[model samples]
Target: MILRVLLISLFLFFSLQSSAFSLEPVYSLQDCINIALKKNPEILASKATVNKSFFKIGEARSGYFPQIDLSLGYQRSYLENKIGEEYSKQYSAQMSLSQTLFDFGKTSKQVEIQQQFYKATEWQDRDTVLQTIYSVKESYYSMLKAKKQKETAQEVLKQAQRHLDLAKGFYEVGLKPKIEVTKAEVELSNAKLNLITAEKQLSQALLNLKVAMGAVDMPDFDIKDEDYAVRKLNENEAIQIAIERNPQLQAIKFNKQASISTKELVKKEYFPTFTGSASYGYLNEDFPLDKRWTVFFQMSLPLFSGWSTTYRLKQAESDIVYYSSKEDSLRQQITSQIKNLFVQLKEASQKIETLKIALKQAKENLDLAMGRYEVGIGSSIEVVDAIVLFEQTNTQYWQAIYDYNVTYAQIQKTVGWVE
Candidate 1:
């Protein structure tokens, strides 16, 4: 008896814990975007790349600082001469410092190259962030649309059930035939099937939202309903904004600048590098040691390197042309994308307005049909048709809204809008 009671108590405790764990958290659209920015692997990787590029700039500037090195050695030798055999031991330590006095602005140009590359990486990071935000918004709206579709299915099912009950009552009173009952039953079955499909779609949409948030392991959650205001953009203005703010375009421009700087730095390879060096050394065979010091200046010129320097200069020049061409191509693509998205946004807006009106009319027609049937003036077919029409129009209206929101997100992404 005592063991039985203990087992029951433990089961109850675990049941309570399970219930608490099963509760889902609700998040707004902005909350999902924030989470994605913080946790998305793509965004994290892009940020890491930006940091690495920034460090490269410091690495390039290191060429301007003096380099110091230390060395130590121990030696023992045995020798035989015409008179006798002898052995000697030696210990030595040396420290050396070298500084580049001049490289014809080579170091400065390298630093400039690295700086440009860093700027390009920063813009790339921004582009990743914007893309992630757009993904989150698109998924969020899709999930909302699915949820509304499920609700619509449920409502349709209720109407089908009501019609089934009315058909049975009219038949009992000898006002309707048995076929009417069969028709209502068939409609109810279809409604059930539709509701099941809608539920599955909603589940899939939620999973998609989770992936977009970069939190696939996150617990089940709900999203708050959001309404978007209609917005229209001027084609010329949108194109200008995309040109000015698009991260890809900016990154390409910086890359071109970096290539130009690299070419200039490469040209300096034909010139001589001027450097100064100083060294101090100690040597001894016993406890006390003799000290020696030396200082000197040197110049090194690349007289010939199998034309490697010349080839490198050519490569740098080619990179400049390649990036310049790439920049032109990207600008054209951006302009075209902006134009297409603008047209989509307009079309979605119009559909939303038109579908909303259609949805209202559908609802009114359904009401009229149901009222006429209640007054014994309408047939079962009329009522079922009205319900079906209402459901289709309602679904279309929600779809249009979803399309509008997604198009708006695409436009923002194309324009490089960040928040």
Candidate 2:
């Protein structure tokens, strides 16, 4: 009975674990970002890289530890000569340790270099996370825009159908021209075309969102669209945050520091190298072997390597300087982008409000124009103008919302989150 219970428990455990891995995220933006942070291929690779660096650190430090050896041997000799036959068995054990006496601090410096590289790998992980957040937010906003556009297309189609009905009523009574009916038919056709286009765009956006979430199959999902206007930010504060928290600039700065440390390490090559070793083994002169223990210290001098060390040092130094310059340039570029986006965010906020008002007014005008055209009091031209204006306003509103969301995500990504 216990064995049966254990088997059932195991089966349940495996089933639950499988469900956990088969991600079907009907996720919010926050959930998508969190999943991406955990599952992004680049971030996972960076984690592995950091782990490898840790192992390398241990490998480097192991050089400062001791080593031991043991041996056992047996020999038998048989000769049909003047000499006789002999047999012997021997056993030996030894432990030998060597610490870094001095390699001009080479061992310590190597460890330091590895430590810096690991740190940079940590920074690389952060950079990758920031990129992932940006991507998910962009896709999320894009999906929202696509949804709004589809709604707009449906509204336009409804308006076109109403015009068609009015055109038919007037034509049957002999008050509307035949061409007006034809024009209404054409307008309805165009609305259908737009609806089809909007749906296609929405499908593509949904696929992109799912890809961003790193999900194989996701249920129907909706993005948060309410209250999507950009929030106000003081330019000075935004710039300060970006400068303080930007991962790209910080990562390159770490890389430059690591390169400098490596350059210093290379310069140490001019110093002598010292190592110690010991071993225990059996040595035999006759059929029987004798045990012996041995210990020794090794010292090496780097007189010259045809300028190889010099060239290596020079290359390291150059890389340090080059990366430092690149770091500076990258900071400037980010600062410029932050400034531009600050203005853009502010402008987009104002534009959203403006377009909100415009949409309302256009909707009212379209209603009034439709009423007049149905009674033959309004011209076809006015109805057409109203349709265009209404569509334009909706387009502007949705575009502003998309822009606001993307910029908000940008601001957050620029400012590192509190750990």
Candidate 3:
């Protein structure tokens, strides 16, 4: 009975393990980007900032509404007078309302400033999203590249095994020497080593992809291979698009507008502000209290504050200058980045085309060398050299493809083209 129970338990465990392994999820490039957008910490933080800034607009607009407050108090006092020592208890309740009559657009300017800040945060959030998407794409492409390289390594190992078998057969049949068999063995061992390295690299790439997607407890997963088509882009057009659509540039523009509004608000601080307030209250030492009411209007004028207002105005003006210069700097920086990325993308595209031809030629060379060696017309050295060349060309071709895809992603990010 004990043996039977142990056997059944082992079988069930293996079955469940197999089922779990077979159910691992496969994510596509788009799926990875979606995951990153939803889970990336930077994106979440930026979105929160955007939400916080939106509430600030409402806070600033609150100045347009009346302010109301209520107060209740109880106090006991002792006094010494000519009659003797006396104690008194007092209770009071009061409600008051205050409203700003006018202030030369000070409140309005404050609202405008907050609105501009809200716009800036919105753009900043967009920028963060774009950056996150780019990171996901980069990591996804790197993982794909590693996967392809691993496949290539496996193919080379197969080729090496075939060569070794052929060399052994030739040696046994007296068509080749023992040295040929030894060389083939060495080549096979090298192929196995390369495959091991490729597998390690692939595992590292997967870890990097998981990090980019902000996945903490992700199960083993696979990514589907994708075909990317190349597109032609003009540098001038790309630069123009980046200048118009870049989130950072848009944010800076809004920030500068907010600074200008702040300067306008400060200028109005020098003018007088008119306000009105009314209070109704009851006060008495006994249960039955007397009622009192008062209403008043007041004006506040800034006479002098050690030239602080003047300094504030100057500071606001300086902020405007700083932002203007910053805007210009960003434009130039974006233009330069666009130009550089375009150049890199073009080069990578060209390399893909070139390496495609090279890979084909290498395959033909490897096949011919193998055939010649089998017929005893070619040397083992020739075949080994051909194999190495084929593997190198194949790896380079895939690397070029990876570079093209990554560069294209960067260009999309720089131009604010999200998909």
* Runs with alpha carbons beyond 4 Å of true place in candidate 2: 1-26, 69-98, 216-220, 285-288, 417-419
lDDT of 3 by residue, 1-419 (tens): 99999999999999999998788699999999999888888988898999999999899999999999999989999999999999999989999999999989999899899999999999999999998899889889999999998998998898889899999999999999999999999999999999999999999999988888888568768999988678878889989989999999999999999999999989999999999999999999977888999999999998989999999999999999999999999999999998888888999999999998999999999999999988889899999999999999988988888899998888888889988
Per model, state how many residue pairs clash: 0, 0, 0
Q: How many Å off is the CA of 366 in candidate 2?
A: 1.4
> Following a full C-alpha superposition, what root-mean-square deviation does model 1 have from the true structure?
5.3
In model 3, where is the ten-residue run with the lowest total lDDT?
A: 211-220
Q: Is candidate 1 or candidate 2 better by lDDT?
A: 1
- TM-score winner, 1 or 3: 3
Q: Best by TM-score, which number?
A: 3
Ranking by TM-score: 3, 1, 2
TM-score of each prediction: 0.91, 0.84, 0.92
What C-alpha lDDT values do all the predictions have?
0.92, 0.80, 0.92
Worst lDDT run of 10 residues, candidate 1, spans 226-235
Q: Least accurate stretch of 10 residues (summed lDDT) in model 2?
A: 87-96
